[model samples]
Target: MSNEQVVNLNTKNKKINNRQLVKLSIFFTSVIAIMLIFLTNVYIVKEGEYKVVRQFGEVVRIDDQPGLKVKIPFIQSTTTLPKVKMTYDVTEEEINTKDKKRIIIDNYSVWQITDPKLMITNVRSVTGAESKMEEYIYSVVRSELGSLEYKEIVNDEKSSRGSLNEQVTLKVNELLQKNSIGITVLDVRMKRTDLPSENEQAVYTRMISERESKAQEYLSKGDASKNRIIAETDREVTELLAQAKADASVIRAEGEAEAASIYNQSFSKDPNFYSLYRTLESYKKTINDETVIMIPSTSSFAKYLQGNN
Candidate 1:
C-alpha cells in the first residue's frame, strides 16, 4: 500500500465509525423516548375515586376499579373524581311564604357523585359541579318555601300544620334527579328557622296581649262564679229559716187546741166538783202561815179562812 491509499482508507474507516455512532445514538434516543411515553401514559385508580380517560377532549374510557391503567401518551388524559360522599352547608336565606311572612332558613345537604361520566360531561370540574348543586338547591328550596304559609313553615305541630321539611326534601330530591346532575342526595335538613328581629318583637307583644286578655277573662269569670254561689247560699238559708218558723207556729197551735179540749172535757164531767175545787183553791190563796185576817164577816175570803159559811 502507498501513502495516499493508507490515508484514504483511514478517512473512510473514520467516516464509517462516525456513521455507526450516529445510528447507535438515534436508536438509543428512540428507545428512551418510547419508554418515557409509556411511563407518562400509565396511571393508577386509587381507592374512593374514579378515573376518566379522555382522548382529544372526549371521554374514551372510565376506570372504576382500583388498579393500574395505561393510555396513549400525549393523546389521552385522565381525570380523577371523588366517589365518596360530599357535604354542603348552604348559607341562611331569607324567604317569604304564601302568607306574606319573612323568615330566615339555614340548611345543609349530603350528596355523592353517582355517575362520574355524567358529572364530567355536564360539569367540567368539581367546583363547577358544586356550583350547579348550590343553584339547584336554592331554586328548589325557594320554590318549595313559596308554596307554604308562614305558620306551616315555622310551626312544629305535625298534626295541625303538617310536615314541611319532608315535603321540601322530597321535592328537592325529585328536582335534582330530574336535572341529571349525577348526584345522589343522602339527606336534606333545615338547621334553623327564625323570624326577623322586628317581627319577633311584634310577636312577643302580641303574645303578651293575648295572655293578658286571657287572664282578665279568667278573673272576671271567677268573680261571677263566686257571686252566684254566695247568692244561692243566701237564698237557701232564707228558705230554711222560714220553714222552721212555720213549723214552730203549727206545733204551738196544735198544743193549744189539745189543752182547750182537755179543760172543756173536765168541766163537763163534774160541774159541782169543779165549783168545789175552785172554792178550795180560793181558800188556799186566802190562808197563810201567819194568820192576820183583817176582813169583814161578809167577806167570802174571811169566812172561808175562819171555817164559817
Candidate 2:
C-alpha cells in the first residue's frame, strides 16, 4: 500500500469512531429519559398504605389497593397515608368535675381512615386527621366527665366504673361524622384522672374532717347509751335496798311484839318472881368484876343476898 492509501484508510477509521460515539450518546440519553419517566409516573402502593395522587395541589385520586400504580409524568405527585388503625396519646389536661373539683386527665384514642379522599380534602394527612379527632375528643371528654362527680368517675373497688369513657368516644364519633375528615374513632380511654397537686391535700383534709365528725357523733351516741344504762342500774339497786330495809323493819317489829306477849304471859304467872328475876338479870348485865358497891344496904339485891343466910 502507498502512503496516500494509508492516509485515506486512517481518515475512514476516524469518521467511523465519531459515528460510534454519537450513537453511544443517543442511547445513554434515551436510557436516562426512560428512568426519569418511570420514577415520576410509576409507584408502588404497599400493603398498609394509601397512595394519594395530587395534581396541581388538588387530590385527583387515591390508590388504596396494594399494587403497582402509574400517574401522568411531570404533573402528578403522590403521598401515602396509613390505612391501619392509629393511636394518639393526648397531652395531659386539667379539667373540672361537676362538684367543681380540679383534676388532671390523660387519655388516648384509637382511630382509622375510612374515606381517603375526604381525609385528603379536609385533613390532608394522618397528622391533620389526628389533630381534628383530638379536638372533638377534648370537647367530649370535658363535657362528659364534667357532668359527673369527682368520685363517680374515679376507678375504685367501691365505684361501679360506668361507661363515661365509652360515651365520650361515641359522642366524639358522632361529632366527627359531621366533619368530612373520614376518621372514625374506635375508642377513647382515660388512663388517669387525679386531683391536682395543689388540691389533693385540701380534699384529703376535708375528707378526714368529715370522718372525724362522724366518729364524734358515734362517740356521743355511745356515751348517751352508757349513761342511760348506769342510771337504770342505780335505780334498780336503790329500789332493791329500800325493799330489803322495809322487810327488815317489819320482821323486827313482829319479833318485838312476840317477845312482849311472851313476857306478859310469864309475868302473869308469877309477878313478884318476875320482878326479882328482872332485877337479877339487870344486875348481872350492868355489873362486871370492876364494879364497886356504893348502894345502901336497903337495895333489892341486899334482900337476895340476905336470903343466902
Candidate 3:
C-alpha cells in the first residue's frame, strides 16, 4: 500500500472501529437502563402486607400474596399496607356522662385493612384511615358513655358497662362500613379512664362521704340490736326474780303450817305433862332473882312443886 493510501485506510478503519465502539456502548447502556428499570419496578410482598398497584396515581390492583412482584415500569407504582392487625392509640378526650359529670377516656383499637383498593380510594393511607376511624370511635364512645352515669364508668364492681367495649366496637364498625372505609375493627377498649384533675378531689371527697355514711348506718343498726338484746335480757331477769320470790313464799308458808301441825300433835299426845311443863316454864319466868310470884302462877307452881297436879 502507498503511504497516502495507508493514511486514508487507517483513518477510515479508525472511524469504523469508533462506530462499532459507539454501538457497543449504546447496547450496554440500554441493557443497564433496562436492568435499572426492572429493579426499580420490582417489589417484594410479605406475608403481613398488601401491595397496592396504582397507575397514574389511581389504584389498579392489589397483590396480597407473599413473594417477589413486579409492576409496569414508569407507568405503575406500588404502595404497601399492613394486612395484619394494627393497634391505634386514640387520643384521650373528655365526655359528659348522663349525670353531667365530665371524665377523660383513653382508648385503643385493634383493626385491620380488609380491602386495600377500597382503603386507598377512601382513606389513601394508614394514618388517614386511623384519623377518620378515631373520629368515629370518639363519637361512638362519647354517645355510649354519655348515656351512663359517672359511677357506672368508673366503678368496676358496680359498673353497668358489661358490654361497653363491645358496643363501641360494633357502633364504630357500623360507621366505618356505612362510610366504606374498608377497615374493620377487631376490638375496641378503653385503655384508661380518669377523672379530670379539677374534679378528682371532689369525687374522692364524695366517695369518702358515702363510705362514712354507710359505716354510720351499720353502727346505728348494731347499736339498736345491742339495745334490743339488753332489753330482752332485763325482762327475762325480772321474770325469773319474781318467780323465785313467789316460790320462796309458798315454801315458807308450807313449812310454817307443818310446824304448827306437828306442835298440835305433840301437845295432844301428853296434855297433862305439857300442862305441867308449861306451869314450870311460867314459874321459871316468874321466879327471877328479883321476882315476886303472881297468884295464878303461884297456885299452879305451888301445886306442881307439892306434887299435887
The most accurate candidate by lDDT is 3
What are the runs in model 1 whose C-alpha is more than 4 Å off?
A: 1-36, 158-162, 214-309
User: Candidate 1 vs candidate 3: which has greater lDDT?
Assistant: 3
Query: What C-alpha lDDT does candidate 1 achieve relative to the native structure?
Result: 0.81
Error of 1 at 183 (Å): 1.6
- Model 2: colliding residue pairs: none
The predictions' CA RMSDs to the true structure, in order, are 9.1, 7.8, 5.8
| Better-scoring candidate (lDDT), 2 or 3 | 3
lDDT of 1 by residue, 230-281 (tens): 9999999999999998998999899899998997799779986676677788
Over the stretch 1-309, how does candidate 3's per-residue lDDT look in tens digits? 899999999999999999999999999999999999999999999999998898999888889889998899889998888999999999999999999999999999999998777778888889989999999999999999999998888888977665999999999999999999999999998888898999989989999999999999999999999999999999999999999999999999999999989978998999988797787787777787887655564476667766776
List lDDT for all candidates, in order: 0.81, 0.87, 0.90
1-309 per-residue lDDT for model 2 (tens digits): 999999999999999999999999999999999999997799999998889899998989989898889999889999888889888998788888899888998999889998989877887678888888888888888888778888787748544334776788889989888878788999898888888898889988999999999999999999999999999999999999999999999999999999999999989999888988898898899889998767657777776767731
TM-scores for all predictions: 0.60, 0.67, 0.74
